[model samples]
Target: MSKKKDNLPNPFNEQPLGGLLKSIDGFFQNAFQNFQFVGGFPVYEYETETHYIIEAELPGVKKEQINLDIYSNQIKISVESSEVIEEKDDKHHVYKSSNSFQRAERYIILPFTISQKDVKASYRNGLLKIMIPNKKKRIEIE
Candidate 1:
């Protein structure tokens, strides 16, 4: 009798449907957040004891297409492109067309004091690197 009771399966062993549904819902929420599209450039900020580096992944964009504006305590990057249409042929024959685009603005706030004069920006291999040196005090811009 004791051996048969030990071999019997527990009737309470079952999957909790509520807990499983919650887990499935959480997975979909995370997947949707990561799959969203962002039109602007992707940027990352890195900091050191002496300086801060702001790098933007700007592929297929020309060096001249980006503009950096340094305000009182913020740096804004704006890119603009436009498409132009050129018609080389007439009516029913043939036509050559081209499109242009304009870049939009991206803003970043600085955690440390940075002067416009001490900032350096460069573009290499489709990446835009901006180096901002640390300053103890704010410098007046003339």
Candidate 2:
């Protein structure tokens, strides 16, 4: 009867609770999977009126694997990974490789002039520290 049909809930208007839960579960699962691709790598930058210091944490990486370049008002750091292979037997083996990682270029505008020749760097405990010294005043002879 028309009255009985009206009393029943509309199928199209009904919410799919199971489907909503499934979608939320799927989203979290995919996010967790993607997080595994990104490991831990932190960079710290400190600057004083006289100098600047940049430190990077690079564990399990060699000093030769890192590259630092200085451009006008900017500094770029990058890391290159070496290929490694492991052979368990004639039919079983594993190959591990990674492409180079391009770090973000840090832009620093100096309050005063600086000289590239005065820049000094050191690596210790999986950390790379760079010290950039401000240019010294030169006395002029009249």
Candidate 3:
């Protein structure tokens, strides 16, 4: 009797597996439902001796929807999206309507010493790339 009891697994009492699954579900729920997390707004940063680069994943976003503010010690990135894309056939009958706005004011703040005069930004293929040169150097890298 004792051996049989030991062999049986606790379906509702075992916590390791259940707890892990619950946490995973909560993570996604919070990230999506609140809109504030948004998977941390996935970003990558690189610093060279001459410049600093920041690349952020922003799919389905237009170039006009993005804004940036650069200060001597901090950089702020804001993305506001209010786009309504529609497609029509030759008959002028609209069948499809698309709205590409999953987030608004997705602000990213970071600290760096950068020059404002030579700041460059571009968006291509769902990615936003911004380059800021170090304040101490005016040399541009090609």
Candidate 4:
């Protein structure tokens, strides 16, 4: 009886649903691991004893259009930008395009507590840099 129980057939192993589920799972795994879908937002982060440095790329965005919300250990940044493109083909056809996009957001999570009020950010040359101060205070002992 024990031998018969151990040899019982596995239903999923003989079904097409198992392969379909595996194919779906693999497609998503490859997409996430390739990092192509979210390739527009490139970030570089490093940690120090007193501060966390984060640099990101936001091309053609102005400082006034950017927003930042800081939490104990998370950083959220968003921006909106627009552009107007106009072209004339010789003397015949004229094309004009006005495109607007909102909510280019990048959220970062860290292990250390950061000061919300003291966070500093600077933007120049299509690059944005931020420095987050550690909440843990250092006491100087003489």
Scored by lDDT, the top model is: 1
Root-mean-square deviation of every model: 15.7, 10.2, 12.3, 13.5
TM-score of 1: 0.60
lDDT of 4 by residue, 1-142 (tens): 3545578776665657776677567655643342222435787998789777899887766788777888878888777554443545767565434343335678899777677678899999978899977556669999
Can you rank all candidates by lDDT, best first? 1, 4, 3, 2
**Candidate 3 lDDT, tens digit per residue, 89-131?**
8786636554544544444444555566778888999798988
Q: What does candidate 2 score on TM?
A: 0.50
For model 3, where is the 10-residue window of minimal lDDT?
30-39
lDDT on C-alpha atoms for all candidate structures? 0.72, 0.60, 0.65, 0.70
Q: Which digits, one per residue and each the tens of the lDDT, describe model 1 over residues 1-142?
A: 3545466654444356665566567655543232222367788998777778899887767887789999877899887666555666666566645454444677898876567889999999988999988664557999
Better of 2 and 3 by lDDT: 3
For model 2, the stretches where C-alpha displacement exceeds 4 angstroms are: 1-40, 86-88, 91-115, 135-142
Which rank order by TM-score, best down to worst? 1, 4, 2, 3
Top model by TM-score, which number? Answer: 1
C-alpha RMSD between model 1 and the true structure: 15.7
lDDT of the structure predicted as candidate 1: 0.72
> How much lDDT does candidate 2 score?
0.60
Using TM-score as the yardstick, the better of models 1 and 4 is 1
